[model samples]
Target: MTSAPARTERSRTDGPAEPHRRRRMALALAAGGLVLGVGAIVTLAVWNDSEFATGTFGAGSFDLQGSTDGAAFTSDAAAPGKTLTFTLDADTLAPDDVVYAPFAVQLSDTSTNEAAVTIENVIGGTIGDDLTYSLFIEDDFGATCSAATPPAGAEVVADRAADATGTVDVFDLTAAGEPVSLCFVVTAGAIGQGEAGTITWEFAGTSGDTLP
Candidate 1:
């Protein structure tokens, strides 16, 4: 009896099909990993580049000008009545800046009665010798005044008061001109330097007159 035809050996091609399936699976896993890595990089870049905060900065600047009319303690033997004019200027300055201004004058008396001679006597020539007169800008805030030299014939005194005033002795007066200046000094609470401000002084009296 013819035994059942031996079954044909299963085709050996099935072995090759198993390896192909494994390769496809591995390719799919690698693609998925690559996609995940790209997504993570994109997220980090966006977080770092974003503008999370904001801020602002600003700045500003100032100047001072001053003038006086007469010097030399008003000439001796001058008219009884004379007036002196003074002017001050505050240049453009920052709001934070502060300024202080002070001034002084020199005078003298040739007459023996120093008590009888008044500012007028010095100005009028009633007292011929040189004398000094001074005015101070009250220090509303504690501050200092700047020092300056007088004209060629004038002399500047070295006396300074804590109250923002300066003084010159009668002997310091010159026949030439008065020493004048605008002082810019820093005080507590001042913001910065170069702030502009001005100070002025005016004198009016008879040349030979005296003040009470």
Candidate 2:
């Protein structure tokens, strides 16, 4: 009797099993890796755009006055006839930088009378040699009146010896009704990284026939 027909060998392709689950797992892993890489790049970009630090610098001002007309006469010094006050503010400034402030005075008057004025720098004290300043004068018509050197025994004060910071007071008399204007030039020394702040100036003076 003939043996039962030989059974056909099962072929790998003929089976119901497939690589679908493995392929799906691989695709999911690749997509996850791409998302992680993009997230890391975005995080780095944001971190680089932020500022580590910041600061600001500025100056304080005072009102100018005159004795005679109050409206006609003006002195570079504060409230002409009163003690002038100057305050320096060095806030948030880099420790290495220097600051400087320059000042100029103008006098004007409508009357024919001539006026005389003087400016002084009073910081630490007179005897201690702690004060310093330069003087410049101009007439009502903006004409140069005279130039003078630093007063005897006067010291030029500065935040740093190499770079100085201070004020200039201008004193002068006007004719009678003319107008006068004063200008101040301010400067800061080589700023170091991270230094920031403001400088304040306080001036008080009296407007009279003569300077005190």
Candidate 3:
């Protein structure tokens, strides 16, 4: 009888063991591939660079003030500003009568910028219609508004009807607080004996490095 195919001892021993060894080798190779992918990703993350920047800042100040006596400076920013301390009978009225007052202007000591100042408006009440007025600048804080004629070398800023509007002159003040002395001369114009009222003058100042 034909004998069944021989099973060699080598075949029996190698068949199953060979398949198991191959599976273990394939698992080791797959783990090695995963480790290589993780290493490459980490290398990309480590190779990096960057940059940045920043800043700082601040501001300045401006102010204006007035003095009626040319000694004590203050702000009279609105209508009916500091009352003009006129010489002679300011309250009394006769034709051709005249009176004088002293005033001064300057930038405040702490002001950080220079200015251009103006006599922006003049308004009169009941007595305003019956008066004429003039503004003059003098060298000293003491006034010459009462002089029979404007003082020698005096500068006239305004000579107009008592009831007038708009700026008559523009003057300058340095940031270091230089002073400008002013004089007001008011004359009666046949006003009635019983007439009495108020007058207001407004000064406007603009802060700047150059005049505006």
State the lDDT of candidate 3 residue by residue for 76-188, as single tens digits: 67677788788777888787888887788888777777777777545445777888777777787764656554443255554577776667655778655677888877878
Best by TM-score: 3
**Clashes, model 2:** 40
Compare the candidates by lDDT and give the number of the best one.
3
lDDT of model 3 at residue 4? 100
Candidate 2 lDDT by residue in tens digits, 102-205: 23333333233334443333223121122122322223221221112212222222222212334334344443443343322223345454543332244433
TM-scores, each model vs. reference = 0.26, 0.25, 0.81
For each of the candidates, the C-alpha root-mean-square deviation to the true structure, in angstroms, is 22.4, 23.5, 4.2
Off by over 4 Å in 1: 1-5, 44-212
Candidate 2's error at 3, in angstroms?
99
TM-score of 1: 0.26
Query: Please, what are the lDDT tens digits per residue for candidate 1 over residues 1-212?
Result: 77888887758877688889989999999999999989878843343455566678543111111123222333323233233222222243343333334433333333211121112112222111112223333222112343232222222222222123332222222222323332223222222454332222222221322211
